[model samples]
Target: MKGSQLGEENGRRSYESLRRTAQALETRADIARAALRLFRTRGWAGTTVRDVAREAGVSVPTVYSTYGNKQGLARALADAADLTAGVPRQLAELEAAAADPPRQLAAMAGYDRRLFERAGDVLRLLREAGRIEPELAAVYDDGRVRADETRARVFSSWPDGTLRPGLDLRAATDVYAALCTVDVYTTLTAERGWSPGRVERWWSDALARELLDR
Candidate 1:
């Protein structure tokens, strides 16, 4: 009888610990979301950890303890965004159309268009904020490297004899990366007022003409 009672108490303690951990994670997510919102609307220079805490409905100390600092919270937001995952999934889907290089290029452009349409604002905010924040700058640089690598992988996977004559793999990859950057997306969609569909079609046609044989 005593053993059964003790087992129940231990189980209850374990359950409580799990509950507490889950609650902590929830709080952290709340704080990150709040910080991202403030960063987007207020800009990085204007947003503060205290503002995030107030927006998240948690105490300032909790925000600090969970994320360590503003930079830490920003990093957490970047991770949560997982900007790296979308490209690979899109590329993988392009495998089925690999036999037709033009079609594959079009698919890639479609992917970029969708990605920017969904996250362009957040990405622009991060890029602008990185100018002032050293830590965020590093994160932005890392993201660029990852994006470049993805572009390289896609170029490498192209069927032989498909690339335009005289364009080396490195040069071609560089051109593709440059053409499909967040800056270009922002300029076309936000600055020039081009529609998302128009931008996607242009990218598809442009990339195909630049990278593939006539």
Candidate 2:
């Protein structure tokens, strides 16, 4: 009887611990989502840790302890979005289609479209906020560098005759990155009221014309 009671007590404690860990993960996700929404609607400078805490239905200390600060929260939000969006899988698909330059470029454009659709406002807010916050500025610059590198790699994978005459791999990558930026997406879809499908088609067509021989 004593041994059975001890085993049941240990089991109960293990269950409680698992429950607490799950709740913590859920709380963190809630906090990240709240921060992202606030950042998108209010702009980074306008949104505060208190705002996130309130929006997340948690205390300020809890937000602070969980994420450290607003910058931390923003980073967490970006990380969560990236993980949820499965960017690596998209990149794999793009790489696999590299033998077909037009198809590869279209896949790249499609990836950009999906990224912007998921987090355009958040990215814009981060860009604006980065001007004032050094940490965020670093994060923004790192993202740009990574994007440029990815574009350069994709451009490099193509055959010599693919790009327009007089355009080297570096320049082509630069142009491609600029054309597929979140800012352009926002301008076309949010400001100019172009449909998402139209934006995607435009991206595919523009990249094909600019980068491909045919």
Candidate 3:
């Protein structure tokens, strides 16, 4: 009977620990969703700890306890958002989609379109943070370089590749990313107010001529 009771106690302890962990994760998720909503609407400076606490349906002290401070809260919120977005999985999808150029570039275009459509919200959050939080940006998450390498491999072996002589796969891929970086889109569309059609035409021509065409 004593052994039975002890076993029961251990089982209960395990269940309790699991329950606590699940609750903590749920709370953090709530905080993250609330932060994004608030950040999108109120910008950075206008949003407060109290605002998150209210939206998250938690106490002000609880917010402090969970995230430590405003910046810490923002960092946690971003981390949580990344997790919810399944960005790592999306990145894997990106690599898999790279088998075809028109398709790979299209996949990239889809991702960038979603990113740009939410530019106001994203820019506001970034502006609030000023610089990327060091902890959030890690060397292990260098998927961009890996993706670039993959593109280089795919492009360098092209039948027409020899025409570019010393350009090489890696260099060509690097140039591809440089040309398609968000700054280019922001510059042409947001800064100069170029028509989307015009921008697309120019981009398509540039890619076909410089990369695809012999």
Best of the candidates, lDDT: 2
Model 2: which residue pairs collide? none
What does candidate 1's lDDT look like per residue over 70-144, in tens digits? 887777566545543265567666787767777877877877787677766667767787888788888777867
lDDT of each model, Cα atoms only?
Answer: 0.79, 0.81, 0.62
* Candidate 1 clashing pairs, residues 3+ apart or interchain: none
lDDT agreement of model 2 with the native: 0.81
- Sorted by lDDT, highest first, which candidate order results? 2, 1, 3
Q: For model 1, give the 10-residue run with minimal summed lDDT.
A: 79-88
TM-score of model 2 (CA atoms): 0.70
lDDT of 3 by residue, 69-169 (tens): 77666565454445543555546656785555554444444444444444434533454355565432421133345547656665654555442556766
lDDT of 1 at 192: 100
Question: Which of 1 and 2 is ahead in TM-score?
Answer: 2
Error of 2 at 106 (Å): 1.0
lDDT of 2 by residue, 1-214 (tens): 6999999999999999999999998888888888877876887768899999999999999999998977787675665565554677778888688698788787778777877888776666667778888877776777778777877888888778888998898888877987988889989987999987789899999988887776
Over 4 Å off in model 1, which ranges?
Answer: 1-32, 48-68, 80-92
Position 141, candidate 2: lDDT: 76
Model 3: how far residue 152 lies from native, Å: 9.0
